[model samples]
Target: MKKEGCCLYYSRKSPMDDVPEEMTPIWSCTNEKCNGWMRDNFVLSVQPRCGQCDSLMEKSERLLPVLTNTSPNQKKN
Candidate 1:
């Protein structure tokens, strides 16, 4: 049993802590009030529009792990 005033606090690790990350292309909404962003690899078209506000998105890069599917037709074994 633990005492009320003597408890220890442990912070949980972030979900991305163990995953490999890289600087990849990203798209952010141009609208000042919109907080929309998307991984460039996940977008269907070269120029993607913001799904939240249907506005044009600007290209940028961010430190994020590879989260997009590179092979769409590859069979899973």
Candidate 2:
């Protein structure tokens, strides 16, 4: 029997962790009216068109800026 504070665990697997080696993500499209964007499996030969506007698409890398917390005194008010 397992103790109140101690227990045994078993190894588990998920389908999401089984991404094929050749799987590659390619940008589908981005809505100009909104910030919505999407990607599809290129190597997997899945949906190759934009799900939003059915527009032709290409692979792209999205970049996000990093923000650092500043001290209260450092903030200009």
Candidate 3:
């Protein structure tokens, strides 16, 4: 018979594991406590606001995957 261990351990996979990413332009919330950010290209307005805290966001950079355009006419040069 084997004895069981008393310690409880857990391991979680990182969300970014195996995903290709690059430093891209983004907007981060100005609020110090907020960790909200958004891709610059995805925002509809010239000035963007944080979706999480409703605060003004500032220009920033983040490591993210290159998003592809679905339009056939939008081929990259």
- TM-score of each predicted structure versus truth: 0.66, 0.30, 0.61
lDDT order of candidates, top first: 1, 3, 2
Candidate 3 regions exceeding 4 Å error are 1-18, 69-77
- Tell me which of candidates 1 and 3 scores higher on TM-score: 1
TM-score of 2: 0.30
Residue pair clashes in candidate 3: none
lDDT, each prediction: 0.83, 0.46, 0.81
Q: Which ten residues in a row are the worst by lDDT in model 2?
A: 38-47
Model 3 residue 27 CA deviation in Å: 0.4
Query: Can you list the residue pairs that collide in candidate 1?
Result: none
Instruction: Give lDDT tens digits, candidate 2, residues 1-77.
Output: 87687678776764554543443344745556533344342223343456567665566655322233344443222
Model 1 Cα lDDT, one tens digit per residue, 1-77: 97677678786866666788899988999999999999876787767899999999999999988676776743322
The digit string of per-residue lDDT tens for model 3 on 1-77 reads 99988998676865666678889998999999999998777776778889999999999898888775455543323
In terms of lDDT, model 2 sits at 0.46
Candidate 1 residue-wise lDDT at 32: 99
Alpha carbon deviation, residue 58, candidate 3 (Å): 0.3
Give me the displacement of residue 69 in model 3, in angstroms: 5.2
The parts of candidate 2 lying over 4 Å away from their true place are: 1-25, 30-36, 40-47, 64-77
